[model samples]
Target: MAAIAQERYEDSYLYRLRHSAAHLMAQALTELYPGIKLAIGPPIENGFYYDVDSPVVIREEDLAKIEARMKELSKLDQRIVRMEAPDREAAKKLILEETTLGQGPEVAEYKLLLLEAVPDGETISFYDQQRTDREGKFHRFLDLCRGPHVDSTKEIKHFKLMNLAGAYWRGDAKNKQLTRIYGTAFETKEELETHLHNLEEARKRDHRILGRELGLFMFSPRVGPGLPLWLPKGAVLRDTMVTFLKEEQLKRGYEPVVTPSIASIKLYEKSGHIIAYRDKMFPFMEDEERETYILKPMNCPFHIEIYASQMRSYRDLPVRYAEFGTVHRYEQSGEVTGILRARGFTQDDAHLFVTKDQLIDEFIGVVDLMKTVLDKLGLKDFRARVGTKDPLSDKYVGHDENWVAATEAIEKACQTMGVDYFVSPGDAAFYGPKLDLIIKDALGRDWQMGTVQVDYNLPERFELEYIGEDSKPHRPIMIHRAPFGSLERMIGLLTEQYAGAFPLWLAPVQIAILPIADRHAEYAAELKVRFRDEFKLRVHLDDRRETLGKKIRDTQMQKVPYMVIIGDRDIEQGTVGVRSREEGDLGAMSLDAFIERVKSEL
Candidate 1:
């Protein structure tokens, strides 16, 4: 029934238009490049892309030609028709005959290779765009696709071919590279134009671009890929975020702790991560005595060790240990795009060890804390993803009854809180079921930012126990939660979400005092000291020997929240002119009044 609903959703008018645009693109490719071997063409989020093996290397310059052919074909108002082939042999024969006249053996070889991969007992389908119907109408060209496309080429009027790039045949490094062309379509020209505008805006706020422009972070080729170096400005922002969360955690009964960056390989083995997540983890190093050590890929195992440090009773069941732990993982080069997917990052992680009876309440508390953090960060649009076990997979750990209980506890908590969530089968961690928070950025792209996992296997593996009312040893449940999944990723998202204009409290340089001349420098310095000492605000005195306009422009470009312009008149009256990044300049105000405003904002 869910499959049917998905199919119905895909058959919407917009989806069909995008799918038709994909076919038109493939048709244009075959027509322009005669013998282009097609691999796959499927509709994606905004539109569709087709992968092709071309004789000549395709570049951005070739997109215009393909797009022109598409426009000409669309003008013909061709009717798209679908057909079914009884067997692979029949499908191959039809494709070979149609493509042989132009491309011949190369096209036939490609068709045969695809034909051999089709599963048995499944009907092969093709779509064709017909030109005319004078006496007996026939399709000018056709390609294999299992699709629900638009009625005709006319529906693809508001479409465009975006760009081209090299992609692996099947997204695997082992496969041959193919030229992939991306494009987008919409039901109306206005919608397409709006989407393009949004794309342009997104490019401006792209973290990689903003990171460089703002001098926040950088990557060095010598240091290797997927590793970022935070500059002073960036470090200030990171520290501010960490300090805010740490304070919040402390107020909510979390005890701060620190852990080593590397641990013995045996630790991961006991946590079941070495066996389950070996591919994503860094390799172990062999010492002189043959001891193996690994860069910790996660902090849960270390916290588990802390929990089992000594014997505990039911009174200490709800111990919450928090850490700003840095971990390293070996992500594939292709997957390491930016700070969002880095090699080394810090997790705002916490582990709560509780008795069986305290599981639900503790789980609910974690959820509440997650909401509080998100609210403080101005993230109100989010939904929870309840990751459950996949019965067919061997990746899951823990007993079946424990898995059931953990999944039920999370669902009950979500229900009791009246929060909307969706169940995602097979997305659970190896140890147990988890609840992940999915946040949408300013560009409307969804990111999985925070998570809370319920683990029963870890306690059993480590032999964690507590004395209960009956004076018997009982295993405690482990709850793993990270509000900001990783500090690096959170900053990257915030950079784009806020468009590099962070809130005043979080901005690296909250206020810059720009002295109009050298004579006013002393007053500016005094004001900076006053703000920094009293309010603990990040304030800078711009004593550069530059004009007031240039100074103001420089500070504006840096995106400092506020700028105080000190001139002779204001200095004489012991007042300063206030200027804001968002709002224009306000009239002169006393130093105390300005400090009060900063305090209010903070």
Candidate 2:
């Protein structure tokens, strides 16, 4: 418990402030609405939120009233004092005594719930905000807390209430619904302002809004909730990303393979995903012979089967198989968000089978590849997460020694590469440990984009082995990696990251040829063919009757990187005026110069 607290303290300063603010928020709510019952108040990433059960429904108008009260208490500069109780009975008696004086039975009930859940030998602590006046000492308001709170409420100077939503108690669907209030807090006003501004920027970059405005993608109620339909323009963007990754993988000795969308359920059972991920998996279907088949939620098992298909030797120690494997998982309705969290998506997945001696070197190679891909995509802000085994849980397979070795291998790889990373225990797959990359977008919001896992359990479970130089059968170590994670998710994040302005190489329409008048249409068409044939550029001829300004606006809205405008002067001069999305018009230039400029960018 001390270790956990130390780790939390090292990772976040906002966490302490948010946790303290939760206690203050609860105190303010109890004062404003006397009969409101409290559920749970926990600190989240950006701030803290408390759940309440009340007879009177909270409307939007009430938020300001509550917030004003919170501000008032914060101004009091009350000292936050932490106290420990002997046991559960003492904790319950304290709450009951407070209720008799004027506090509600709700506090007693909440205290009782906490006492029942706390483990034996664990210290039960509470925090109080004490106040005093010239005449006498004012009373104290307290709440159950396991805290590392600031010394005074003055430390909580920057905060705001964000929103309200209904949440199930304890996150179980069967539990009673509680009104959850969400808010954010920062250490300083500047940080708070920056966070709020980032939120606004994220709203503008929301893929659903951009997708509708740019005609990139769509979701239909008739089709499904988490499934999306890619429009013509979106398809081009998706294909471009896939092709880029494929070319990179090919250059690194990865062989592409295709697999079925659905496989026999028996395959998953063997892979252990059926046992561990049963809740997230879709229902199975039975064929005429009553054999069950399921939509693949992961591509690891299939890739393992492919590796096992051939008898490999020490010479073929590291066999890397790559695929653009599409998978399906059953996400709850509330959990579904745009393309970021989808039911079906394509993963740029690859699995490497290597000898035990080759594990560290192979892992290093994967890290290098990930860096190259992320660099190409302009995702420079990312940190690695070393997901390790859960000691207390039986969810993972493999011997203890193997798990230790795999975790150390990943840690060594990170150290050797000189990258920042954090360890996340119990975050690994049941089979083995992994390295997950968390990336922040332009709005300063984080998203997990890539993962690389080191597995010893799967090879053991599948009995995967290779002949050593001594001609003895030895177990092989498997490295599962995907730089993009998923095509759908990467595209969605990239869309928002770039704010719909993709790079020249990744843009669906690289160049749009706009003719100022009908007389220049022949020249624009001829130029389009030449660009397509010679430069392999995605070029479109705008032959519509719309004016040149309107045509430029339309193509700009589509996020085309370049626009080639041909008019009387350009036709006569054997040159075309070039306009860029990032840079405004570059005066008329020869076709050769235009191609050279674009080639340099690619």
Candidate 3:
């Protein structure tokens, strides 16, 4: 489904329009600021951006200037034309001349480098926007790029420069930094306005802001970047999710296992992760004997070692080991975004060892489990994606036959479950194919959460075997599953999904007992204790000396599901004032009635 969406997007006129708009923005930048060496510009998921080494520092205020120039240039109705170069030399000449304008060869620095980086014998192309202004003056802007852009500049009408950020050339930190200008374009004025409005809503629901406001989690620069400190409420939330998943796994006959944070490098080397995941792995550590160890970037290698600890028979064919394992990777400082893309995170990881005959059924079970998790989270807008290995890539492990079988098994399971999915080549893990749940949030943004991968390579790499019905040894296929890809990522998404007002069952504090006055504090405390002991509910007693209205407002801001208020009248009547986050005030209710309400919410 993700692939289809991508294909439709790439094939859409909006894509061409956006791509041309990027070039238009680049043109405006070149006109407004001389000696701006242009880097690559491409249309991305939600918009397009152009990276350039500007002689003058470009700030947020500069976006408006460039955007205004783009608007004026777009009104000129320049004809867009595609041109091809016969050889690398000709391409270099085009970059030094036509693209250089009056800035000389120094300004063509990145363009020349881009041309040289193009593989030998590959077709070289450029896009040229040309038109005669009303004053009969001819104006044109030429850029070195593979072209399928809009036919004219007039098509890039509705666009806005979003912001500016620093981007390293080709995403390499060692390379020179460039200014990246982000912007979005739409097919119609109304659509553009709607998109801008949605951006506003998304800002209001931004997880980083809400994560702190709701007190679910906190990050301290004193510790480090991307390593979050789970506060009391946040810890409870994590425990709630873990406990629920553990119970579900228990019902499904999965055995719980634990692994360490760091492991000997030999383990990953044997599983082929050391090579395939070298870039993401933290720096290797050396022991006295020259033995290498490193922080684990994945849990699969450790689980594989456990599976190989003892010989197995067909009767014990499908062995499922589950763990809420924490792993660390060296994410670039700029790429790390709060907990969503944290360097240290926990994966609700599990590995299933099964025979060839059991592959389809095992895959079906994994998919069903993933679906159950998504459903429980109240995430209905999602699509299944089968990520298969790229045929042209040699970096992938395993034989072609194994890759084909694993891909087919995942597809078959989706078919059996009647779940719609699309195949996305080149997205598979290095060792196997995977099924990803791409969730669409309230703001129409897609997030790739929860993944189930079918692997025939890892077992083969480790030579994991079991005795079959024929009394012969056979390699067992492995299923790598993480219904919540990572607790941090899932919680981040959920925080934004509910806007921090979590469901009653998942909320850190399900109920709050607020005393209307200092005199009523005693009754409120009693009700809180009773609620906790009887229902095992996460209840809090707000016995503060503040005014009743202030306490109620504070509880509401905390997003507690329900609040029980005890005042003189309530204590005298043997009742409590019940107020719900969503339903406002429900007046006075007996303690028994409130318990039923909480139970119903659960």
Candidate 4:
């Protein structure tokens, strides 16, 4: 069913239009830079990008020139024709003779490499675009591609080149870097304009910019990339989430546990992480006794060890250990984006060891808890994705039966829970199949948040067991869950989703008190204490020697949910002037009335 939905998009004209737009861009690049070597160009989720080894350096300013040329080429009505080569030798000959556009063999470097990498049984195909101008000058563009393109370049209109980026060839650091040109296309001018407008709005909501402006977090060059230093406000937000999740876990029968930040290398080796996840892990360190240790990349192994430490019967079959474990991964500098893709982050992690009979119930409980968490976070737009191992991939461990059982268990739980999910192959963890919540924020961009994985393999690898009714040892199933995925990434999403104006309960400062004058400062201080201590609200007292309007503006800029102004008349009347973030100022209200209003919002 999911494949059908995916195919609907893949078979749509928009898809072919974007694909042909890539070809149109390539044609423009070839005309602009004669010796440019086009590597690969494909239409992506929201746009398309083409990587090319250009003869001249491409800059942001060059994008305008490229777009102008693309616009002219798109209207030329050149026929987009697909051709196939009979064999590898014919393909190579076509690439050198036609794809190079008479520029020389050196320009076909990446294309020949692409041809060599193609499987023997696959058809060798190319996309050919050729035309003669009204002035009788012949112009042609051909490239090696398996194309499902629009029939004419005239259909490749309403497109804009977005930006320029550097991508390593074949995504290998050892290979030469190619210039990546990103662009977006739509079927109509209105859609293209809307997309460009959204791109601008996305820039404004960029967490990296908002993180610093809103005082959430910061990245330091000295501390290293992908390591965020949470400011006071950001720490408060994190604590709020942790407290909420911890309470939810306690209610769901999850016991808290603490583990070391670093574990012995042998521990990871035993769990198979040393082999499957070695690349993402930090460098190993050796102690005085020649024992090697690695910074934690996952908290699952430690939780598994704890479960194995105790001997249990079927009566105590399900044991859940929850922790806010801080882990580090060696994310490449290019891959790290502020807190969203941080190297060091805390996972709201838990591992459940349960008998096969208890698997469905426990999995349902985890999904319920995840829904509750998302509701509280105000993330209502989301979908579930079931990630299964690719049949051709050797990255996974465990037997085929174990893998099948795990996958079935997950699908059953989702079915029982009536949760809609799409199947994604090659997205599973090395251990087992999993379900991930893909959230759409305010900007309509998808972020993979909470996750739950059913792992029979891990328990088998660790020899985890429980005594059955007949007193025979049986292997237990493991459910690894993290509803928030990670605190840093969640906070980043929240920041962008709400644009820093957090809800009443989740806001770092629920209310700010501004004093009208020096004499009002005393009353404001007292109100702050009442709001903070008596009402248990995160309140701030703005008693700075600044103007009243300035204080209000500053508080509004901070995105505080509420503000109370204490003045001579308000202090005399035993009332405070209140202002709401979304609404304008409400007239003076009695202290009790204001408290009740705040309580209702909470």
Local accuracy by lDDT, each model: 0.85, 0.86, 0.89, 0.89
Best by TM-score: 1
Task: Give the least accurate 10-residue stretch of model 1, judged by summed lDDT.
Answer: 1-10
- Residue lDDT tens for model 3, 1-602: 22344567888898899999999999999999998899989999888999999999999987888999999999888999999998899888888888889777999888888888899998799999999867898877999998689998988999999998899998999999999999999999999998999899888888899888888788888888888888888889999999999999999989999999888988888877787789999899998999999998999988888989998999997999999999998999768998999989999999999988898899999888888888899998888888998889898877888888888888888878767788888889887899998999987889999899877788888899999999999999889899999999999999989989999999999999988778888778888788889789999998877888898889998999999888898988898889999999999998788888888868
Backbone clash total for model 2 is 0
lDDT of 2 by residue, 291-389 (tens): 999988989899899989989899987899999998999999779999889998889999999998898888888988888888899999887888887
Model 4: CA > 4 A from native: 1-4, 8-12, 34-37, 53-57, 92-123, 132-139, 168-177, 391-405
TM-score per model over all chains: 0.94, 0.92, 0.92, 0.93
Q: What is the TM-score (0 to 1) of candidate 4?
A: 0.93
Q: Compared with the true structure, what per-residue lDDT tens digits does model 4 show for residues 1-602?
A: 12213455778899889989998999889889988889999999888999999888999999999999999988889998889998888999888787777677999898888889988877888888878998999777887888799999998889999998999998998999999999999999999998888889888888889889878888889999999999999999999999999999999999999999999999999998998899999999999999999999999999999999988899996899999999999999879988888899999999999987898788889988998999899998888888999989997877787778777777776776666677788889887889999999887789999999988778888999899998999999889999999998899899989988899999999999999899989888888898889999999999999999999999998999989999899988999899999998898999999999989878
Per-model RMSD to reference = 2.8, 3.2, 2.7, 2.6
Relative to the unseen true structure, what is the Cα RMSD of model 1? 2.8
lDDT of 2 at 405: 82
Deviation in angstroms for 557 in model 3? 1.9
Error of 1 at 243 (Å): 1.5
| Poorest 10 consecutive residues by lDDT, candidate 3 | 1-10
